[model samples]
Target chain A: MIEVREDWCKGCNLCIERCPIDALEESDVLNRRGIRPPRLKKENECNYCRLCELICPDLAITVISDDPDEEEKKPVKKTLLTPVGGKIK
Target chain B: MVEIKTADELNKKFLREGMWPTIFCNGCGHGVVLEYTFWALEELGLDMDKVIFASGIGCSSRLPGYINADGLHTTHGRAIAFATGIKAADPDFHIIVFTGDGDCAGIGGNHFIHAARRNIDMTVIMINNFIYGMTGGQLAPTAPLGSVATTAPYGNIEHPFDICDLACALGANYVARWGVSHPYQPIKSIKEGLQKKGFSLLEFLAPCPTAYGRRNKLGDIKKHWAWYDDNTILIEDYEKIMTYGSEEEKEQVKDKIQLGVFQDIQKPGFFESYEKLVDRLKEKEAKTKEGKK
Candidate 1:
């Protein structure tokens, strides 16, 4: 699963363009900035390739998974753990 | 293994704390380029304090301010000249310049050419957005022929500049061009540019969605990226086409943006040549003194 920080999203649609599987779509609702942010359309199809994360200019998207093996692959560093209104894990 | 971190982690490590929210428009590729630069610097383990970032007036010029380093936001189109002075005075200081197409190729064309000709030790990152994005979408030197801008509403009739070709011809030690769609190549190119000894020019074909895109009917960021993906030709392929293909085939691929290291030669830099001249003069002076004695 991934989290889209609605506040930071500028509705660039780059994530939509680069997603290999059609797992993301533009939301009808606009964020505070009045730009429609993309949302995960098919959650199960997401392989966490992180193409969207790499291409996001605003750094608004974060790919999060509960798999411990995948977490071990990531660097051990202090990461920003919360979205807009969510609690830090 | 230097662990691979997320973009957010990298941002926290390198970006200025208070400067959250960049001024670049949504979907603008400037931020992506900046991110790649920061990543390159980080991977290289360069000390921020020892580096001097200089930029001229443009949307891309604002990049230095966000990097948390000693930066000179100089006058319009004079960043290269200012950086030249900085590099000449303190040859050890790692100098990096951020300039846009209009600022570097248009207003400061002479400086751009001369700097490359001199083969000074510095890395220049030119963001070619195809328009004067900050000053409201005026026609830029890098704008493609028949592209629409605010000044060229009907369509631009003027030809665009191939900056990489110009730099390569002028004897720059390193030269490369990459679009924003290919993230890995740009970062790799930038890293190579930073490591190079003499003049290095990295031209990034960025998108100005608000200014150039809206007017050209390519407002959608995805479409703009797709255009870049479709139009760009790899440098190796370009060379193959030029070498073996017929005149007709060459003409067919003429319009595609050739992307890769156009030049990388081991030539003595300006400063090194100057030092050699000084050493020769000193030796001659010593010889003259001995003769007089």
Candidate 2:
């Protein structure tokens, strides 16, 4: 399931733009800030890519999985790439 | 399957409590840059007490206020000057100065250049939104050529300053520029800047949708990001073009904003040199006293 913190959403449409599966769209209802926050259109079709969460400037979007077994897997450590003109470690 | 963490859970680790809902406008890229900064800080495992965030007057300067750490919200265009004094007094403190294009490249241009020349032990993150967002959309020093601004209603005739190139020219030990679209790169660049011993300048090309985008007819937030994606040419690719391509090709790519580190070298910071001078002076004084005795 995907949840959006209504108050924090700024109506950037970044999540809507980056959603690979067309799972999100701008809602007609305005939040307290008078901005139209994006809402999940097709919850079941979501692949849980987390692109919205990563791309969002505001930490408004949250993606949760229904499977309890997924929680038991250890988080993989991501190694950062060395910048250009700098030596790689 | 990857473990999914909620936004609150991840944000709460670095963000200061009670500062919920930042002052940034919808689709403003400053928030993304700040998030990347927090991620870098966490990766480095820096003690918040040991870090001092100093900022000048502008939209980006407001970042220091949001973070729960010691920060000096100094006068307009003087963040680097204040940070210099702070670093000189306490060399142990990790000083990071958050500035905007107008604040650093316009009013504080001299300080910015001199700080890099001195190679002070500090990190300077200049968020280039192209226009003076806080001061009602005035044209900034980094504003693109032909861009519209309040001050330049007829479209700007002046050329924009390439901050990364300028910093690299001034002998800055570390310098990098990243657009807001690239999340991972900026975080890594920030982390590398933090670890470097000398002056480090990380220029983040943030989208000021309310100020810059609307004025330039860039449409919504997505269009602004698309503009960044289309206009920018990575430094690595740029270098390859320069090496192999003809003069015509090079001129065609000239308008593209070069991203990535322009310079990163090991150098003695100002404080280290200052301490050496102090030690030399003390030894000379002792020698003179012995001679008199």
TM-score of chain B of each: 0.94, 0.95
Highest lDDT: which candidate?
2
Candidate 2 scores a chain A TM-score of 0.69
Give the runs in model 2 whose Cα sits over 4 Å from its true position: A27-30, A39-49, A63-89, B1-6, B246-252, B291-293
lDDT of 1 by residue, B147-234 (tens): 9887888999888888888998999999988887666778888999999889999999888888988888884876776667667778
Those runs of model 1 whose alpha carbons end farther than 4 Å from true positions after fitting are A1-6, A25-30, A36-48, A62-68, A71-89, B1-4, B242-252, B290-293
Kindly report the fnat of each predicted structure, to 2 decimals.
0.29, 0.46
lDDT per residue (tens digit) for residues A1-89 in model 2: 67888998878888877676666788899999898988777545565767677678887777786687554433323422223322211
Considering the two chains of model 1, state its CAPRI-style docking category: incorrect
Best by TM-score: 2
Q: What residue pairs clash in candidate 2, if any at all?
A: none
Please compute DockQ, using alpha carbons, for every candidate against the native two-chain complex. 0.18, 0.31
Total clashes in model 2, counting residue pairs 3 or more apart in sequence or in different chains: 0
